[model samples]
Target chain A: MEPIAVISIFVLAVFVGFEVVSKVSSTLHTPLMSGANAIHGVILVGAIIVADHSSTNLELGLAVAAIVLATINMVGGFVVTDRMLEMFKGKK
Target chain B: MSRTLYDLIGLAAGVAFILALKGLSHPKTARRGNMIGAFGATLATIVVFFFVVAPKTGVAHALPLHHLGWILGAMAVGLAIGVPAARKVQMTQMPQLVALFNGVGGGAAALVAIVEYLHLGSGATKAEVIFTVFTVIVGCVSFSGSIITFMKLQELMTTRPVIFPAGRFIIAATLVSVIGVGGWVVAALGTTPLLILAGLSLLFGVLFVLPVGGADVPIVISLLNAFTGLTVAASGYVLDSVLLIIAGTLVGASGTILTRLMAEAMGRSLFGTLFGAFTAKPQAATGAAEERPVRSGSPDDVAILLNYARRVVIVPGFGLAVAQAQHTVRELADLMISKGIDVAYGIHPVAGRMPGHMNVLLAEANVPYDQLEEMDEINPTFSQTDVAIVIGANDVVNPAAENTPGCPIYGMPILQVANAANVIFLKRSMRPGFAGIENELLYDPKTMLLFGDAKASLTKVVSALKAL
Candidate 1:
């Protein structure tokens, strides 16, 4: 199969996925985002795995870079979110 | 083996995940949505790693072992920080957390593009450089802007708009110069110099958002979230990653829509959000003492009013989220229901901190979804309501948002709680809300202020209702 065809299939799937999420009521967004964020951590793991398996220097470097960036995003996201949640605590 | 079949399966999983997330919009179904999203992400990772990269490498190694350690270590660190932080943080700070998360996502996506550019060595093609530049700028801005938002929300930074004599021009000039230098670096020096340029762009991003007032944080957060999506999409282009492109675009589009909605809710222009423009302040400190006259109500008087009201609407705000009083409120609602009075909850979109905050609190109390109504759906009914019992909420139900011209919250959509025959405000004190503005509803002739801890106050109200 052509790469374009594979990519197109994936893109279509994402669109369908978005449509499904949009239909969800507003009440669920916070939990959904929170849970989905945890899953983004997997992106870091994937990048590291990719970096470890790379035969070429270029691929390895790219993988390493991806790993660092993904990790920052995943960890940073949770920290900021936790701090924000603190504002609502202990009110009258 | 037919790769097409794998792609089809991956696509199906992605679709399923999106639908699951949507279904999760209600608190009851949110957990299921999370499961579905995780499943979909797993499938995506498997497809990308095992099917695409493995086949490309064809038995040859694709990455180093240390790279793998970095990923695992990052995850470990993230969990270490995230778990305890989440456990300790209260619900009021959720919006800032969300903004911070969105920033991180954008920053990560940008970093991916930067690394890719660096790997291209000295002489990259024009197209490669352009995409790299786009990713870096967007990602940096998103990251820095989001961090500043976190600072503001955490009260680490001033909530008031921070402005200087030439703040706007300086920001604009800096952005233009950064882009110019970025283009030169990409065109001549390649990716190495681009890193420095990216740093400058990030600084500009921070400065851009810092001048904005706290009242505009929600809009700014939403906008930054969209920027993150765009950055991810750009990263996809650099990596030739289909999944990233798809996911990023979805987030980008939806985030844009949400941002616009938030701006409209606040009755602010999109241009105002972009330029950090806000009305100049009156400078007078309007404390609770200076707010409109507060008519205090004793528990017995409130009980008498609650006992006779045929219908009631309870409006919960950040105060309720702070007190974690959903359970007590639910008990109160139940007690009222036993008296044959119809009780419903009115939820404002911007209530609490993030969207759906009130719903989350109520769901925790096991309140039925049907009993919760949005601002618009419940506003008209408030006029007919015998009692509008406000619980720990302020800005969302403030009469000023509806009637006070030139007020900060004026023109912002709000629940018409003031229209009710009798209003009861349950607050610890006469503190201003998140916007730092007075709630005129408190001073209304018919309004009664019952000051105390929300949980304790609700408990008293519940017992009084039962006794009555």
Candidate 2:
């Protein structure tokens, strides 16, 4: 991808992000934070790539550790956010 | 598998992520929203692994899979640790746990960038090198800053602002050096400079968070979350993945807005919070603390007060969380309802450690959603209320926020519980709140202090109400 194209996507996503979460009720703020926290675990994709491509044993070890950390972040974040959202949903 | 097909899957997952955020804007669809997000993430993971990276054909073959077992094994280990911890972490500890989880994501991003840099080894494009360095810097900072936040929240370190002479200057110097090294990395695409850049970035993270007072930790956490997001997006740029770009930017932007909201709630500028020294405690007169008289009340007295009150408001704060008193507070409110006394809860946005933290705790104890009134809605009714019961709340009810000039928390919004006809404060001592500022509202003529553990006090009050 061209640098210009990537920058354009980044710009558009920023606007979308700022717009999407404008008026979240206070009660949902923690859930929203945790939920957004989960999304950044998309870096796990990067980790998987790193693990697959490494040559040296030392690099491989680091990549494996990265993969595990990213997975924990992804799984824990989504599940915990779901647990919190469950409480919110049950409130009604 | 066709590469275009994989990109389509990634695009679909990005759309799912959007729907997830939309769902969370309202409570009605939030649970389903979370499920949709989790699904999107899973789909993206599967596509990236099997179709995009795992194939030993095409340009992707350069980043070849060395061992299949390590990847699968790491995921298994992750699931083993993550699932149970997420399941069992107490509600009171959620803030720190979230910080810890955010740190792990940051660590992963940094590690991914490091390994990728090693693999690419100067053969990468200028754009790729730039993004990888960007990811390394932000990822390392987020990782370290989040751990410090976790430690502060967990009480493993002092919550007070830790500052030395010329701290801001040191932070500035560190940042400048990091930028210099970053420029070097981008120009030369060298691996050796990357490590030093990461190390300095990590140091900057520590220095950045060290002087922030405890009251602003949530804002810091939110800001760090955004930092992590930007790192993930930079990682996406390095990997040429659109899903990571979309998802990371979404988090970065939303987290930025949330941080702004949090700082606004406290009536402080983001710049002030980042660089300003926070010491809210009022200076003592003559270096000798004079004893101020406060009316002491027992459970029976509080019950008697509640029995005849026409309208009651319950104010809950972090102290309530610390004492695990949500369920008992609910019992007391239920008893008040049975007697036909109008009752509602007043929640300050910053009442607990994180935004909406008190609401989560109360909801878990089965408190109805409608009964938990926001600060704006409940503040007006406090003046007409017959009694305002403050359960382990101090700072949020302190009138100094609105009335006193030169006070550190001045201009910040607070629940006007002091305006009620009568106010009962359940506290452990005369000590100040998390901000380390004295709440002069305790000395208000109509106020009475009921000192004890919030849970035990509320339980006794419940029993007394039952006996009545």
Candidate 3:
């Protein structure tokens, strides 16, 4: 990727990130934070990508561990956020 | 998969994430928004198995989709552990659980960066090396900082701010060394320098979270969440994945905004919450040991006050969550509503360890949404209420937040329950709140105390109200 392209994407995403959650109610703060926590779990892609190329035993071991941890962060995060939001769904 | 197709799918995943975040900001769309985020993340992870980042020339490092068995098995293990933990965790413990998960995510980002850095070796471009160093440092800090927060929230450690002599200088020096070593790694590009950088960052993370008292842990957690997001973005740059970059940046952006908003809601400066303890004035010793006479009342007295009140505001705090008394409080609220008393719950933004935590717990106990009023909404209504019942809560209702300048909790917004015609507190003991500051409202002449476990007291009050 070009440096200019990466910078452009980075700057634009920052504005989008700021714009999305600016109006959220405090009632949903926990879930929103948790949900954002889960979104970063997408770093699992970086883990898997690095794990695929690990030529040595040490590198492979660390990458695999990263994979496991990222999965937990992602899967567990969404599930918990859902559980938190479950109560809101049940509200009449 | 062809490179074009792969990049196209990645773009789609990124767009899905934006929509997910947008959906989560509104009440009606939150659950479905989370579902969309889950879907997008799953899609991205699975797509990795099919497509690969093109390897640069002479880099025989990663064969396409290598170690497929290990990757699948590891994910399964993650699933086995994550599902039950998320499902079975009690609502009262949600804050710690969130902290724990955030830590692991951060750890994962750091590990991924390390592996990628080693794989790149000296062949990495200057920009790539800088991003790798950034990822490694921030990820490590976020990882360890989150663990400290988890311990504090779990009561595995003291919840009070840990301030030692010259603590500010020590923290500042650690931060300086972390940067110095980070520069060494970027210039020298060795495994040892990077590893040392990681270690220092981890130390900084622990030290950084230690001085934050319990009441402000939520803000720290949110800020660390942003740190982890930036790490993911750095990792995305290292791996050259637009999906990772966009998703990470979004979290980074949103987490930063959310942290600021939570601080504003609590009437705290962002800098004050993070570094205030270093320069804090030692609060005067509380008179907790003096055994001052408080007007202790029976459950019948609480019941009588509630039975005749035209309007009632119930204030809840961390102790209520600690005692798992959300259900009991809801039962009492329902009972009050049945008696035709105008009932409302004054919910502080920072209530129950995390923002919005009480609302989730109360909702679980079937408390109606409309009855749960946020701090901004309910602060003014207290003056019109006949009885203000505070159940297992202290800091949120403490007037010291407004009156005392040097108290740890001073300047934080508090429920103005003092304006009510009567104040009733059901507390376990006379101990000060999490900030280790005494609450003057408790000693008010109009305040009535009913001491016991929150659940038991609420139950007794429910029965007393029933007898009426």
Best by TM-score: 3
- Candidate 3 stretches with Cα past 4 Å from truth are B57-64, B287-290
Task: Give a tens-digit lDDT track for model 3, residues B351-460.
Answer: 88888888888888887888888888898888898999998788888999999997778899999999999999989999878777787888789999999999999999
Candidate 3 residue B435 Cα shift, in angstroms, is: 2.0
Q: Considering only chain A, what is the TM-score of each predicted structure?
A: 0.58, 0.95, 0.97
Off by over 4 Å in 2: B52-58, B62-64, B278-290
lDDT of 1 by residue, B123-235 (tens): 45566577678888988898899889999888897876788877778888989888897878767865557878788889988988987777778778777776776666556
DockQ ranking from best to worst?
3, 2, 1
Candidate number that wins on DockQ, 1 or 2 = 2
| TM-score versus the correct structure, for each prediction | 0.82, 0.95, 0.97
Candidate 2 residues B63-177, lDDT tens each?
A: 2255778888998999999999999998888999899999999989999988988888867778778888888888888889999999999989988678787776898999999
- By how many angstroms RMSD does model 2 differ from the true structure? 2.3
Give every collision pair in model 3.
A53-B62
lDDT by residue (A45-69, candidate 2, tens digit) is 7888778778899789999999899
Global fold similarity of model 1 (TM-score) = 0.82
